[model samples]
Structures are given as structure tokens and as C-alpha cells.
Target: MSTNPGRVKKDEGFLGKLGGTLARKKRSKEVSDLHEEGKNAINAPLLPSSAELLPEDLLLEENAERSMLDPTSREDPKFKDLQKVLIDWINNELEEDRIIVKDLEEDLYDGQVLQKLFEKLSGRKLNVAEVTQSEIGQKQKLQTVLEAVNELLRPQGWTIEWGVDSIHSKNLVAIVYLLVALAMHYMAPIRLPEHVSVHVVVVKKKEGILQTAQVTKELTTTTEMMMGRFERDAFDTLLDHAPDKLNVVKTSLITFVNKHLNKLNLEVTELESQFADGVYLVLLMGLLEDYFVPLYNFYLTPESFEQKVHNVAFAFELMQDGGLKKPKARPEDVVNLNLKSTLRVLYNLFTNYKSAD
Candidate 1:
């Protein structure tokens, strides 16, 4: 492997042709020395042994020197301060990221230590919050709220029914209130829950082929029978009779039409829009449970049934006038009797009527 061609050169003549032999050896030696000098200048300390060396010895020498890539053991003192950075960089890129090392085994042989040890360490704090949610918790919450309402109404002989509802959208929790209406008395503007958007409307129903009072003449009847009471002429108009655009503030009602009506599977159409329909339904349900049911619970006395219906609807109106801003301070004194008026209407619609479509 000697590139020191002059030292290895022999003074020999081919077939004893001394002049020609000596001249060729001298030329070869000059070329070898020039190539060796250039290679050493190109990569001084970093250069591997010249390739002309014997293969076995050449590789052995390379291994004998600490590799520049091995920062921890390589004897470049400048590398001493950069071991942590080198380890981190290798972990991110070259080492396939086995960096989550949390061993405190206190049983490592020196040869088993993979990365260099840390000398200085600093503390760090992580910010994390814990959260928990469960179906059991949600069901329990619904049950607890229902139970309290039921218990409050128990003395008045009012029965309460509750269950989960299938929802196309979770925001339409209003469907939950509708499903719980076995607790209410009348069924016109089905009550709503709180904290949802809603529309309270003033709608008119006919009675006995005559124009009549919505409250007085519409009593003791389901919605189907009441609609049937209208004259054919009135029915024709009724189909088109959008309720007067009342200034409904706090009260909310969902249009029971097509995709807007179904709490599940609502679809949007270019011809019509379901504006706040899901949110409206939830809001109405909240209003029902929060305001209507409590009022109905208080007035379960026989005579109070009719008045409660009229008053609750009126209260819904008053909400627009900004009167019913809050629930009555004493809820017990204000609730009215349940005459099965609302439930009776609901049964008629749910069980007996043809599809509203």
C-alpha cells in the first residue's frame, strides 16, 4: 500500500536491460508521489487510507480510528459539548425515534449503555387537564331531572313519562322534550326546552263550520277533530294560512312540515329552508319543561285545566311582549291542573290522523 513509491522502488532491469528498467521505475515513482500528495491535501485528517493499501489492513485501520459519526466516543473535544444535540438529532432522523426512554433500572453494564449519559438536567412542567364523559352520566342526568319534576307533580296526581329520543342532530335535543310530552296537558305549541332558538306563533283553528274563539270553542277536542270542524272553504284557506307574523320573542315553535318536522333525517331543499328548525325544537322543549310543565303541575285542580291551557298560550304571547322574561318566582302557586287536554290531542295526532303531508 505504500504510496511512498520511491521507498518501494527497486533498481532492476528487464532481462538485464538496466537503462530502460531504471528509467521506467523512476517515472512510475514520480507519478505515485504526485497522486499521494494530492489525496492527502484534499482531505487531511478526515481522509481514509489511500485505496492502494491491502484491503484487510486498510479496513482494520479505519475501524481502529473512532468514527466521526460517533459523536459520544469520537475524540474531537469540540464534540463533547454537543452530545445531547447529536443524540436528539439522530433520534429524530436516523434512529427511527426510540427517544422515549424512561429507564431507572440502576442495572446497566457500561457496554449496554446506548446513548451518552446526561450531566446537567433541568425540570419542566406540563399543562394537562383531565376530562370524563359517559352514557351513564348523561342518562342519570336526564333521570334525575325527570324524577324531580315527577316528584313535584306527584301530589297533584299528574303522571310523568320519559325516554331517550333518536336524533338526526344532537342539537335537536328538542325531540327529547317532545318524547317527554306524556307529562303535559294540551298539545298545540308542544313545549320546548330552554337554551335553544324557537319561534312562537299565533295560529287559528276553526270550530263547527264557523269562525270561532281559538280558546273557548277549541276546547275538549283533539287537533284532528278541530281541523275537521272547519268548512271546506276554510280548509282550503287553512292550507295556505300561514299564521299572522306575530312578534315572537322568547317563545319558539318548529314548523311541523316535511324535513323540518322530523327531528331525525332533516334534509335541505332549494325551495324551502329549515331556519333554526333544530335549534328551535330544542329551545321549545326547554321552555316547555322549564316553564309550561311547572305551571301545569300547580293547577291540576279540576276547574283549572281549561284556564291553564288558555293562560299558557297567552303566556307564550306575553313572552313576546317581554312580560314572561323569567319564570314565576313561586312556581308552585302558579302551575295548573292537567286535564289530559294536551295529551289527548297528542294521542289523536300520533295515533289517529293521516300523515300531515
Candidate 2:
């Protein structure tokens, strides 16, 4: 059977064209699919690699579950007591500024109160906005404040456990840890309830499965544990080993006293002799309490020894009224210029009102 050569050639060409068209369509579909995948890659969220996951990142991921078991949420009695003590201490420090911190999470999340506190404790101002309303602004302010704080604490070899995101997110565990650290650093007079602990939910990923475990975390350790023995016995150690440092302590205390008393046109030069008369003591109490003591309540001149004792006693009474812890020193001891007694009273006042404006 002889087929026509031209017809055969034409049929082969047509088949070749059809095969080329089909191949072109297949290539176009593959290219389209690859382009679509590229677009997805560009639009998709970039997640951290396994090696990039930090402890803080892990903690943040578990926040939702951990929050439910937080101390503030559960109202754990011990934790509540610790919170009250810390809150009261913060309120006392910020009393002059009229900033009250009822909840550590809410008030401190914005970083304004924390900034004020750092300024009050360190006597150094931070370069940050006075008020930040927006969430981003608040976080920026928190970063600045925490950086400054870490700089201050770095010399002491303190470990910072909180981060900006942790604090801004109102992580109570991180918040309380930070507050406790600040209190210890500043030697806040208020006693933080010791050995406070809370239950927390810790999450981890194993293989591909999520695992959680409840853990008892200690919120605060005692001062002795947090600080070295020398820090705990600093005054006594200074007195015994380095008596000259006592002068520095005295000078610092005098400076602190004069700073507050300067408003009344008074300066404390001699801590022992000047306060022995009891007039300065009375005025100091009145100034710190933000109230005026009636002239009749205390003697202005106080020449007589008994009159001086009476004035000192009246100042002690005012201290008690102002919610200050009662002084162990007797009124007569202060009147007699007993350095120990005089220092005890003044130190108490200084601890309580150092943040006073």
C-alpha cells in the first residue's frame, strides 16, 4: 500500500503542532503554579526558626494559659499580701506626685509610674515622655526605663528576668519580680512578705506535640538571699572595718535631710546637735506629713530640757499619726543628742520619706 508522501508529511506536522501546544499549556500551568507559590511565600508571616526561639518567646506563647493561673487572678493570699505591701510602698514613693498604683499590672504597664519610681529611688531623671497614651508609645517608654534600670543594676551583678514585652503585656510574674528587685535595690522600708511563691503553667513543645506543666515559682527571696552578707550588714561592717565610710553615710543622710528641709529655710549641718533641740524634728515631721503643726502643739524655742523632751515626744506622736513605724529611741534620748537614738529616728524618717518632694 503506497500512501502519498505529502499527505503523510502534513499529518505528521499537524500532530507535532498539537503536541507542542499541549506541552506549552503544561509549562504555562507549572509556571503559574510556581508564581502563585512565590506570592504566597512573599505574603506569608515569617516565623522564628527553632533555634531562634528564646525563653521569653516561649513564655509569651504560654501567656494565655499562664494568665489564668497567675497570682493576681487566683488571689493567692500570700501573693496578695506581697502585692499589697509592694503597692503600698510604690504609693508611698509616688505620694508627692499624686500617682497611686492600685494594680501593679495596670499602672506599671504604661511605664510612667515605673519611671517616676526609678527617678525617685535613684534621684536621677530619665529622658522619656511624661505620659504615653498609645500602646506603642508606652512600650517605647518601658524599653527606655528598663534599659536605664539595667544599667544601674549591672554593677551589682543583678540578673534581670523581665523584658519590655513581658512587662507591657501585664505579665504579673514578671511585674512582681521587677517590683521586688526595685524594692530591694532601693532598700524600701516596707517589708515585702517573705518566701512568696506562685503557681505557673509552663509550656513546651516536644517532637510536634505541645506539653504543659504546672510549676511552683518563687516570686521573692529574702534580702539576705538576694544580697550578699556584706550588703545586709553594710552599716555595721562599715563601722567596724571602714569607719570613714560612716562619714559618707552621715553626709548623705544630712544631704537627704537638708533637701527636704530646705523648703522651710532650714539646713541640717550637725545631724546630732541640730536635731537634739527637737525643733527641727518637729518641723521635719510636719513637712513630711504635708501638714502644719500648730505652734501650741510644740515649743518653737525649746530652751528647757523638759520642754525639748516634750517637743521630741510631740514629734514622735506625729510620726505615729503619719503611719510611720514607732521609733525605738526614747524622747529623752533624742533630746540628749544621743547619736544612735537621733540617727535611728532620722533614718526611719529618711527611709519613709526619701521620695518626698
Candidate 3:
């Protein structure tokens, strides 16, 4: 029986013969080692065909076991002392908040919370006669910074889109907000005084390695586009409340990327930017998100409060530079542990718990 005409024979060339010989040798060497090592193999012990691992053997409760063995558990005196210090710090913070709240209650009828905040911030008390004078001084100081920012952006023709309804009214709230805008502008890790272009790269996790999936030049433009006509309104709202707009933007951006990542097989390592303004904006936002607490009850819902605590805890784990430390797992573990410790304090604040007593 002859083979079909379409059947192809193996290469009979010298190079092909040599390649085939080398491949065969490699396979034989591998099998020989496996056979030789089989009796005393560096492998798990042989198991019965239907065997299942015991719960203890699987080490699922390893953390509980380790904590029991630990000498520095919460029951230790050192931790108890630390807890006291934490409570004291929280009390101090709450005391400040209470003062602010009392002041806001007085100022709300007049819509003067911003003036009161600025007064408190400046550490000078203003009587009725001096309040306007103090506000003028505050605006002037803020104006100096705003002018500097504007001059910096003027050459580039990239003026910030001030929310027309929100900013144009020139109310005390608006002026204070402008000051915040300037502060955030300056707080940005990158100075925006010079014209700069920005680029963003989207990365994906693939086989335990980060791989670039997409690159967009002008990431701010893309984000602004995503924000659309509501950009200014959204920014105004951030300035209006305790939640840092910059933080919200960044978290929302990263979350957006991660959410859409489905089957794209990507874990976010970090979002990176070359633009000084963009980088600085991110840092400024993170700072505010972690630290800024609204004095009044308007912005103090439980969900928002919890989010602020979460953001702050997350920020504490970061290095001065925006990049996450590597190897990534260690920093993440540390952050998680710290977050748990922080949550206890946050819970106390939430429930108005004053002390162990």
C-alpha cells in the first residue's frame, strides 16, 4: 500500500537530521532524570487516589495560628499603650471638628462658613467690623497665587475652566474655593508653570507580568473629554466639599480602567504621567482626599467619612513619590495591616466612642 501523494516525508537534509538528533537527546535526558529521581523525588508525599487534604494541612487559618503564637498581640501592654495614644489623637481631631461645627452653625444663616474657615485657618479672630477686612486680605493673598498660576498658564493658553455659575458669583465660598484651587495647583507634584505635553499608557497583567496595552498622548484631554461639559461643574463640586477633586478623579480614572479591564487580563501597577501639572494634580488630590474633612454636616455622611479614612490610610502607605514600592506584595500587605488598625480608630469616631472606660 502506497502512501497518498499529498503525504510529505520528513526532511532528509543534514541540518534537519542534526536538529532532530539534538531534540531527541534533550527529551531522553529529561526522561532519564525523572526516572532516576522518581524513587526519592523532591515532591509531595504520595497520596491515596481519593485523598483530600485536611483543613489544618491546607494552612487556611495560618494567620490565626500565627497571631496566637505572636508575643505582640493586642493583649500586650505595648499595643494597649499605642491604642491610648491613638484615642488621644482622635480626640484632639474631633475637638477641632466640634469647634468648626459650632462655628458653622453660627455662620450658616449668613452663608459665611468659608470666611469662618479662613479665619480659623489664619488663626485670627475677626469681629463684625473686621470680617470684611480679613476677607479682603485673604482674597488678596489667594489672588497673588491665582495670578501666578494664571500667568504660568497664560502663555500656554490652557486657562482652567472655572465653573461659571460656581465661580463667577464671587461669593466668599467662591473666593475660598479659588484659594483651594491655587493651593492644589501648587501642591501638585509637578509644577505647571511651563508648557508641557502629557502621555498616558494603559498596562495589563499578562502571565504575571505587566504589559503595555494602549498609549494615549494628552491623558488630561482624554479625562476632560470623559468629563465633558460637566467637567467644570464636577470640579466645582469637589471644591465645594471635603472630597478632594483630584483624588476623586484619579481613583475614578484607575477604577474606570480596572473595571473595563475584563478578560483584558490586567492588574493596575500604577498610573504614570509625564506632565508636571498632571502629576502634581494627582498628588494634591491624594493629599486632600486623605486629610480634608468638611466642618459641617452637609458633607459628612457615613459613606463619605469612611471613604476619606480609606483614602488617607491608602495615602499613608505611599512613598513621597507617587510610585508604589516594589516588590509590590510587601507594601500591599503593610497597607492592609495598617488599614485595619486605622479602621478601629475610625469606628470609634463613627460611634462617638471616647475611651476604653
Candidate 4:
């Protein structure tokens, strides 16, 4: 391409740039001057004839209009109001939160009261009741203990018809149910006819490496009742001639469980708890039955301690009667079973008058 030297130089563009630069410089200078004047006004004291410190436009106004003072010199009522309102709001909010927190703490303490009783006992021990057919060549021998259990349960609407091969299994299942009943009440240990743990504790001298018949249970708490124990003598009393008493002892356990469970349903209607409170209650009951029920009647004397636990189920039945009398209906037939409070409160508020020292 041929170079064109005839094109007019762009003097207009250069002039426009120059003009824009000059305009910016003039504005900067004006701003600097105004800043210097404001600095002088602040640094210098007011003169006797000078108007009050105000914008220049205010000084030229009529005398009455001269009340327009420096905006900074006057207090802002709106700002003060906003500050007061904010402080008052904050204080009210803090007070409300404090009340809510106090209420929560009180409720928490109330819920855990009954669980404390688990720790009140001196302690708990293992109670095993086994009947082996091989021990005394009694393979075909009838289980009077099992019969007694069935006899006791029949009146309570539980069926007891086991096959020849299923006899032992049926017996075990029955024992489990009994244990479940025991734990349900263990949550609230009752006052026996005499002052003793309704449960029993079987003791045997250490044969080889075994030292203690004491049994261990899992706990979700660190309360005093967690480690508390019951005396051995109190526990063994249940095994005293249980079979003889089995006929008269009506199993009042099932009715009591049904009543309390129904109450729980009513109380918890539409109410939600952050903790799985209902689940905890059921689990506690299961643990009581599985871990604590059998041992509630642990009984092993120096003589029968070496031999296997015999008449295990019979012993349970015998407990109802004082060995004192033959199986008969109690004078009072209407058994009362009502839980005073929910499981959570029961556990927290759990306190035994006898255990209190």
C-alpha cells in the first residue's frame, strides 16, 4: 500500500485531551482551597464580630434565620431515640432468653429424678436358675417348676402348651417374660411385705477362679443409683419354696405394664422431645428384664450353692406365698397399677426414702 502523507493531523483530538486535563486540574485546585479554608475556620478562634460557625450561605440570611448552627454542634434526637430503643430491645431480648434457659434446666432436672434410684442400691448380683435332665438321670422327669409357672400364667391369659422337644425352650421363654416383668417394676422397686429387695441374690463360694456372684449392668448415667447394690440376704428370699406358692401368685405384671404404657401414650400426645424419651423408657425396661430380672432373685446357700439351681421356676412362684401358706387368693384381689409420672421424670425424680442417709 502507498503511504498517504496528505491526511490532516488530528489537532482537535489533542486539544480535547488538553482541555479535559486542564478542567480536572482546576477542579482539584478549587477543592484544595476549600479544604484549606475549612481547616483555618476550625483552627482559628471565633472573632468578636464574626457570625457563628456556619456555612457561608447561612451568615447572609436574615437574623432570625441565623439559628441554623453547625449541624455537628446540635444533638440529633432521632439518633438518640434509635440508640435508646436499640438498647431497650437488646435488654428485653436478653431477659427473655434467660427465662427460657431457666425453665429448660428445671425441666431437665425433673425428668432425670427417677433414674437416680438405680444408684441407691448397695449393688446387684447374677441369679441363674438351671435345671439339667442329665444331672440325676431324670431325662423324663416332669418339670414341676415349669408346671407351676404355667399354672400361675393361665389365670393371666397366657397360654402354656409346649411340645416334648420344645419344653426346655418354652421354659426359657417363660423365664424371659418373667424377667421383663421384673425390670418394669425394678424401675420402681416396691416395698416388700418386709424390708428387703423383692429380688434375690444367689451366692456360691468361689470354686476355682470365680470370686463374686455379683453381676454387672450397663448404665447410661453416672448417678449414685448406677452403682448402688442390694443385700444378698434380701435377694435370696425370693427362692424360698417358690413352687409351693406358685398357685396362689397371680402374675399382676402384665396388667401393670399395659396401664402405664397406655398412660405414656396419653401424656406424650402431640408432644415432641429432643431426646428419644419413649425409646429410652422401653430400652430401660428391656435392660431391666434382660440383665436385672433373673438376678433379682439370686439365692445360693453354702449347701445348695454347689449344686445347679433347682426348682428355679418353682422358687419364683414360692416367693408370692410366705411359704407361710398354701397357694390361695390374696385377701385384696384388685391390684392397683398406676405410674405417677413419665419415665423421664421417674428416672430423674427417682429417690428412695430408705436409701437416703
What shift in Å separates residue 111 of candidate 1 from its native position after superposition? 61
**Which digits, one per residue and each the tens of the lDDT, describe model 4 over residues 65-98?**
1112122212334323322332332233335334
With a 3 Å backbone cut-off (N, CA, C), the pairs that clash in candidate 2 are none
**Count of steric clashes across candidates, in order:** 24, 0, 3, 39
Off by over 4 Å in 4: 1-142, 161-164, 169-340, 343-357
Alpha-carbon lDDT of model 2? 0.77
Which candidate number maximizes TM-score? 2
How high is the lDDT of residue 122 in model 3?
Answer: 43
lDDT of 4: 0.29
Q: Write the per-residue lDDT of candidate 1 for residues 69-113, one digit (tens) a residue.
A: 221222334222223323332233223423332221111111011
Local distance difference test, per candidate? 0.29, 0.77, 0.34, 0.29
Residue by residue across 1-357, what tens digits does model 2's lDDT show? 898999999999999999999999999999999999997676343322222333544554432432224334347788899999899889978999999888988888889999999999999989899888999999999999999989988687777878898899887888888888887776565446668888765545444333455567787776334422222344456656998777887887898889878998989889979988789999988888889889998889978776888988899999999998888766766665656567778888888999998
* Best-first order by TM-score: 2, 3, 4, 1
lDDT by residue (tens digit), candidate 3, 255-300: 5434433223543324332111122222332332344323331222
Off by over 4 Å in 3: 1-130, 133-302, 305-357
> Is 2 or 3 the stronger prediction by TM-score?
2
Better of 2 and 4 by TM-score: 2
